[model samples]
Target: MKHALNNPYITRNFNPNNWMSDIPIIDSLSLAELVLPGAHNAGVDKKASYTALGISHWAACQNNSFYYQLTHGARALDLRLEYAVGGDGVGTFWFQHNGFRSSRSLESLIMSVIRFLDENPDEFIILDFHQLNPGNQRFDYKEFNRLLLTHLGNRLIPSTHVFLTLGQLKQASHARRVMVAAENHTELDSTYFCEYIEHEWSGIGTASVSELNVHITKVMKFPPGGSLPWSLSATSYNVAEGPVNIREHLDRWFDPALSDWVLNSNIINADFFETSNLVRHCRTANLIKANNH
Candidate 1:
């Protein structure tokens, strides 16, 4: 059953490039209180030719590049990385999805974000390193942190001051537009990295939209106020059921109740995000929250 697409928030006037700045009320809200559209496995995309150890179709979550995703209203990015130790490209980091690794280096993706921030200074971005190739190989946290600081520089919003309003946060870092979140690592400097954003995975790989909705509703029950930011994984994984099919299922379930879904979750992350209405819904939810408060 498909839901009605009469959402008032789904508008043509919303500027994805400057979505946050476009909505003046958004600047006054705290980061924790805002609804952000995020890309799951954000770095794993098919825009460029990629070399994968596993099936690319099953692993690739996005079709656009990092810059495209951000310019299209995605504020949060869920990244998975693996460091190459014994290859020709030793010491360089690569974006990965399970066993599938992109031909693109982690630096390339970071540069993409940096470019977006440069173009849209008022826009805030969240970069969550959800996985760092733990247990499979010896990862270098120290070097990794160094790499981040080098590229990100003063652009990173420090962990000490992440609860401030969007305008306040930009001012705190002297107009910085990005925040980096990694797992609890002692080696990671708290001055640069904030607490890693947690996630509630639905853990289902079914074609049934009803099955997916059960998990989405359960996740919506989570209380909003918290020190650490979190995300709801709004995706279903079925190798046989490709992203096109998954996109249809998501649209059917989320379109009618888009506002409700956005209001309940901090980060509404999904695969094939470009094909979904999450960004528009998030923008509308932010406006709704601004008016209520």
Candidate 2:
């Protein structure tokens, strides 16, 4: 006798109800709403240029996006990669680890992250890998992460996409579905690959850009979609607050190549962080820190 089996939770075709707490943009925004490319604003309109101004990504290592924008001309991509290489970065990938009980497998971590992402879809997620000590047992999680990334090209809605800043992913490659990578300048590796974009980031919230430190990064956006994101969750806040020493911690994003290019990029847009309500971003970043390891 045999029985049929399905994935425990009954995977669907990524129904919004499965993960999205907010209404889908298809329901919220009309096709006409996000249109771009007026007659006057011209650089070089290639066919691949994303004409629609849709989808926004937020992260620490933002300068990566700045570089990408210079090379690639796409309108729909909005990248916010934050380079927070300020952790012990010990073991193997503390720069992206979740500190997961100090003794968990990558599978467990992936499951935890998946569940977390599913449960809280509104919040911008940072799957912090600054604490992982990958070994024989935990290598599965790393592989699973790549698998999930590959699937996202097919899975993500026009509204839902993952934002990432990789302190270390050895050889990452993904499907062409990836729209933007707001990461630092690096050789396109097998492990970490995305259509990089350029964004002007003040490099704030890092160890060097804290209140205690003179350096400051400004918010180009706030509270994620103008409301306190429900999915950004408690754990997300924990990670934002975990770093004790800001300056020493900033050393992680301290790539000489990245810093040099950032100093010479044309990604300066002051409008994103110029609102009175911008304090919400700090609140949110701190909250994310508080919730993570």
Top TM-score hit? 1
Model 2 clashing-pair count: 56
Looking at candidate 2, what is the lDDT of residue 20? 18
- lDDT tens digits, residues 99-153, model 2? 1111222333234334433444332222212112333234333343454465443
Candidate 2 structure, TM-score to reference: 0.26
Give candidates' CA RMSD values in order: 3.5, 20.6
For each candidate, how many residue pairs have backbone atoms clashing (under 3 Å)? Answer: 0, 56
Q: Rate the local accuracy (lDDT) of all candidates.
A: 0.76, 0.24
Q: What is the Cα-based lDDT of residue 161 in candidate 1? A: 74
**lDDT per residue (tens digit) for residues 22-51 in model 1:** 777777787788888889888888775566
Model 2 Cα shift for residue 86 (angstroms):
27
- Alpha carbon RMSD to native, model 1: 3.5
lDDT accuracy of residue 177 in candidate 1: 76
